[model samples]
Target chain A: NAGVTQTPKFRILKIGQSMTLQCAQDMNHNYMYWYRQDPGMGLKLIYYSVGAGITDKGEVPNGYNVSRSTTEDFPLRLELAAPSQTSVYFCASSYSFAGQGSSYEQYFGPGTRLTVT
Target chain B: EDQVTQSPEALRLQEGESSSLNCSYTVSGLRGLFWYRQDPGKGPEFLFTLYSAGEEKEKERLKATLTKKESFLHITAPKPEDSATYLCAVLPYGGATNKLIFGTGTLLAVQP
Candidate 1:
């Protein structure tokens, strides 16, 4: 099973151009997340969804938006891309069972490298 | 606020060398600590998860131990294939959804 898949493994964007990074998981996970990893920095959450049609802002949500229209897909949108947004993006998902004690071990997809010029 | 810090930002070891990578963390309340291995140009791969102090988990040549305020990933008889950046993350208690705070990670290079 393709645990998680991301589109456009690499991309070059011009400043102020907008783009959307696609992420899909076949694990039937209920929780999905988007994170950006800068050089020598830890992954920073951009957005996440609990389930279909439910999305929430994370630590670094500015300049980014997300939508979870289906259980298997969560997409991150950059309305106005900036050089600061140049980083490696990762998509991850995990399944949570009620009363099972928080076991949020996430499965990540190959990251998408974005460079803003 | 929850935070994680890893020591020796980078390490280089020859095959058969044994070493330990440290992950120190601070959180309101700890729920779980995780270890992941990430190769260049790829996303992190889950390695081990520690739930409480004194809890330890092992896989192949790697062992992870957890304490009240820190976690340690011990590597024994490492091989070149074991080279990767090891990441540590933590899930805090009292969150509606489990969100993890991560460390900068320890990059390990195992030379044969």
Candidate 2:
């Protein structure tokens, strides 16, 4: 079902360059999230969306931007990529069934590894 | 502050050895605790969800038990493939967005 798919399995960018990491989910979920993982560090939320046209900042929202144009896609944009932005990025989604409960077992994507030089 | 901490940041065990991973959290009124498995170059795979103390869940060789302040992921006779980083997260009250506070994770290496 391609639960969550992220584009550019791996990419290297020169400092100051810009790029976007694409994430799409076919599960028709109402919640989508973007998180970045650094070596030996836990995944940090970058941005998230409750549904199309609604997005919010997460724990580490600096150095990144996100847009949710449709329910099926949530893409992350890195402007003027810096070395600090070099990390593996993951996209996740979950159902909003419980309203507030254990329904947050987020399904993650394969992740995109980006290295900025 | 809302936070999650995983003990024994790294662990090494022989195949078939039984052990457990711990995830301790401090939050204001915990809503839920989540466990996930992440393989190299892959995303974190969902594992178990514990809603409250005394709650337990199992799948394959892993069993997760929750207490008021912590959670344990028990591995029974684990295999080499069980080698991966196990992550725990906590959902605090305030919103229904499932905004999670995650731990650094426990990296498990199962040698055969």
Candidate 3:
């Protein structure tokens, strides 16, 4: 199903540069998320959307922006990158059944590795 | 605050050795606990989801057990192919969004 896909497998940017990490899923999931995994820090949510045209901030949202213009795409933008932004970024998607107490499990994409120098 | 922590940060064992990895957590109310396997340079693959205390799930040689306060991933007769970082995550009750809190993960290295 090509479950989830992300672009720019690896990137290096000078401080103050800008870039966007592209993510897409073909699972017809209603929920999509962006997370960054720093060494030894696990994965932290950067942003998420419940459906197309809806986006919200997560635990660590600063220095990042996201837009969900289509059901299959969620892109993360770095307006002005900083060294602290260096990390591995992952995109995940899942479908939740209505009236269910628990959300469905998420499937992840091979992450994008970004380096800010 | 909701939090998840995994123990031994890293482990190494002979191909046939059996061991367990621990995931301790703190949350207002538990909804579900999850386990995932991640290989180098790849995204995490979902393993199991435990909904309540005493819940257990198994796949191949790995078994996951959940409790009121923690979860465990036990590896039985491991193989080199089983070497990877094992991650634990939780979904707390009352969270409108299905955001999961993840642990740093326990890196497992199985030697043949």
Candidate 1: deviation at residue A28, Å? 0.8
Off by over 4 Å in 3: A100-103
Residues B1-112, model 2: lDDT tens digits: 9989998899999999999999999998987899999888899999988888999999999999999899999999999999999999988878868788889999999999
Model 1, B11-111: lDDT tens digits are 99999999999999999999889999999999999999888999999999999999999999999999999999999999998866778899999999999
Alpha-carbon RMSD of each model = 0.9, 1.4, 1.2
Q: Rank the candidates by lDDT, best first.
A: 3, 1, 2
CA displacement after TM-score superposition, residue B38 of candidate 1 (Å): 0.3
Q: Output the TM-score of candidate 3.
A: 0.97
What is the model-wide C-alpha lDDT for candidate 1?
0.94
Q: Candidate 2, residue A47: CA error in Å?
A: 0.6
Worst 10 residues of 3 chain B by lDDT: B90-99
Task: Give the top-scoring candidate (DockQ).
Answer: 3
- Sort every candidate by DockQ, greatest first: 3, 2, 1
Report per-candidate DockQ.
0.88, 0.89, 0.91
C-alpha TM-score for every candidate: 0.98, 0.96, 0.97
